[model samples]
Target: MEVKHERVKQCLEAMMDSGQLSVGERLPSEILMAKEFGVSRETFRAAVKMLEQEGRLLVKHGVGTFVIQPLPMIPSSLERLSSIGAMIRTAQLDQGESRIKFTKEGCSPEAASALGIKLGDPVVNMERVHTANGEPVAFSMNTIPQEIAGDAFDHDEFQGKLLQFFEKRLGRKIVTADSEICVPLHIDRHCQRLLLHPQTTVLMLKQVHYDEANRPVLFSRDYLRNDVFTFNIRRTT
Candidate 1:
C-alpha cells in the first residue's frame, strides 16, 4: 500500500544519489519503471509526483520524466528531528569531511542573543564546511558558550555530530531544537567559495539547540548549496 510506494520513492532517491540516474537523463517509461520496481503504475506515478514536488524530477506531458540536476535532497521530516550527519548516513552517502576553517573565543552580538548570553561573554565560534563525496555541501558557523565548550574543544579532532560532542562534553542531552529555513538573496564570498557555486542561490537555516533543562546551548547558521541539498517538510493537521 502506502509503504510500498514509500519504498519506491526511496529507491528512486537512492538511484539519483548514487548517480545511476544523471541529471537531464530521461527515466524509463512508466510501465517499464513500475515493472522494474515491482510497483503498480499508479503507485509509481505517485512516487514520481512526490519527487517532482521536491525538485528532484521534472515531468513532461508527452516527452518523458527527466532527472533534475539539483543535489540529492535529504528529507527533513517534520515528524522527527535528526542531525544532518544522521540524515547523510541514512541516505547511504558519505558523511564526508568537516573542514574546520577557524575557531574564535569571543561572542558576536547575534551569537549572544541567540545563546541568551550577555554581551562580551566568552563564547567559542567555529566555522566549518561539510562535504559529501569530496564535494562541499554546507558552510556552517556554530557558536557555543565558552564554559560549555571548555578548553578541550580541538577543531582538528572534532568531526561530525556537533550535538553529540556537546552532549557528551556537558553531560546533558539536546532534547529539542528550533529551526527556520529561508532563501537568502546574497551569499558572501567565503561561503560561495566553500559551496563551489558562485551564482547559486543559498538556502539558510538558523537553529538553536536546547538542553534537557530547556536551556539554549548552541546557535548555528548553516548555508546550504541550493543544488547540493533539498529539504522536505510534511505538514499535518
Candidate 2:
C-alpha cells in the first residue's frame, strides 16, 4: 500500500513539472484520480495528503484539491554567468518557453553606455517573457548592436538562450558579464499582467555581456517574479 501511494505521488509530481497540471489549477476528484492512477482510494488519499503536507497542494473541506503555486528557488553562482533558460533546465523544469512580445530598432542611453557605443547608434531591442512549466517567471529586455544583430533576426525563432543567437550569428562567444541584482518596488504593466502578481516586489537583473576580446556585446534588464523565484549566492574563501 505504501509503495502504491508513493507511485501516485511521483506521477502527480511529474505532471506538475510537465505543465500538465498548472499552478492554481484544481485537481480531479479523489475517486477519479484514484481510478486514473489505478490505485485504491486509500492509496490515493495517502498520496494527496503527502503532497498537501509538502505544500504542493491545497485542499478545502468541501471543495477539490488544487495545485499550489510553487516557489522555485534558483541558485545563482556569483562567479559564473548563466541564462534564465539554463537555470530553468538546471532545475529540471519541464517546458520552458520565452515568448517574444516585441522587437524594435532603437538606442537607449543606458544601453549605449553598457555596450560602449555612440549615443545614437542603432541597437536591436527585444522584450520577452520567460515561463517555466507554463507559469511566467521573468520578463526580459535585451539590447544588441545592430551590426551584429542583422535585420534577419526573427523573434519567433527565439526560444532558449539569447546569447546562443548572438554566438551563432556573430561567430563570437560571450566570455563574461557584469551583472547586478536589485529589488525593485514595481514592474511595468506588461510584466504585471504576465506574472499575475502585480503588487509583488520584483528582482531586477542588469547585465552587460562581453565577448572574448572584452567588447560589450549585449545589454539586458530582467525583472524576475520574486514569489516564484528565489536567487541565492554562495560564498567561499
Candidate 3:
C-alpha cells in the first residue's frame, strides 16, 4: 500500500509540474486539501512540509502555503562577451555575491593549460557564488596568471564582474573569450553548496579569455542554474 503522505506529495508535485498551480498561487486550505487527497490533515501537512523543504513551496506562519518561484531567467547571446553580473543587471534583477574566497595558489594542470602557463606556476584564484534577488544562481572559479594579477591585485576591491575588474583595476582589456558548454554528470555536491534542489538542471562553461595581443589572461569554470540562464546562438547560412 502507498504511504498516505507519499501519495499526497506525488499528487502535489504532479499539479505543480502540470502548471495547474502557478508560482505564488496558494494551495487549498489544509482541511480541504486533505479531504481532496483522501488523507487526514496530519498526512497532508507532512506532504506540504516535504515540498517546502525541497524549495518547491513556501509556508507562512499566519498566511497560507504558496508555490515558490524559481530563479529569474537571464537571456544572453553567444555573440557577446557578457559577464554574469551584466546578465543579471540586464534582466533588471538585483545582483549579489557571496561565499567569496580569494587566494594565491599553484596553478592546476587545467588552469595552466588554459592560460598557457607552465604547470605549478603561481596564480590568483577567486571563487564566489552569484545570486539574483537573493537567490543563488551560479558558482564560479576564476584563475589569473600571477604576472597579470600583479602585487596590486586586491580581492577586497573587486566589484562583481571579473571582466570589469581586469579592465578597470589592472588595465587589461579582454579582446576575446572562448567558451565550451557542458552538463555536469553529478550536481548533488554543487546543489548542497548552492542551496539548490537536487534535481535542478545545471550547465557548466569552461572559458579562456585573451587580450588584444592574443595572450590568455584568464581561465574560469562557471556552473550556472539552467532555470536562471538561457544562451542563444545565431545561425547564418
Q: Which of candidates 2 and 3 reaches a greater lDDT?
A: 3
The full ranking of all candidates by TM-score, starting with the best, is 3, 1, 2
Model 1 lDDT on a 0 to 1 scale: 0.78
Instruction: Single out the weakest 10-residue window by summed lDDT for candidate 3.
Output: 186-195
How does residue 46 of candidate 2 score in lDDT? 95
* C-alpha lDDT of candidate 2 relative to the true structure: 0.79
Q: Tell me the deviation in Å of residue 94 in model 2.
A: 2.6
As a whole number from 0 to 100, the lDDT of residue 15 in candidate 3 is: 93
lDDT of 3 by residue, 131-197 (tens): 8998888888899998999974573777666787788888899989999998866635754455467
What lDDT does each candidate get? 0.78, 0.79, 0.84
Can you write out model 1's per-residue Cα lDDT over 135-170, one digit (the tens) per residue?
777778888888787775764556557777777765
Best-matching candidate per lDDT: 3
What residue pairs are clashing in model 2? none
Error of 2 at 121 (Å): 1.6
Evaluate residue 69 in candidate 3 and report its C-alpha lDDT on the 0 to 100 scale: 70
Question: Can you give the TM-score per candidate against the true fold?
Answer: 0.62, 0.61, 0.63
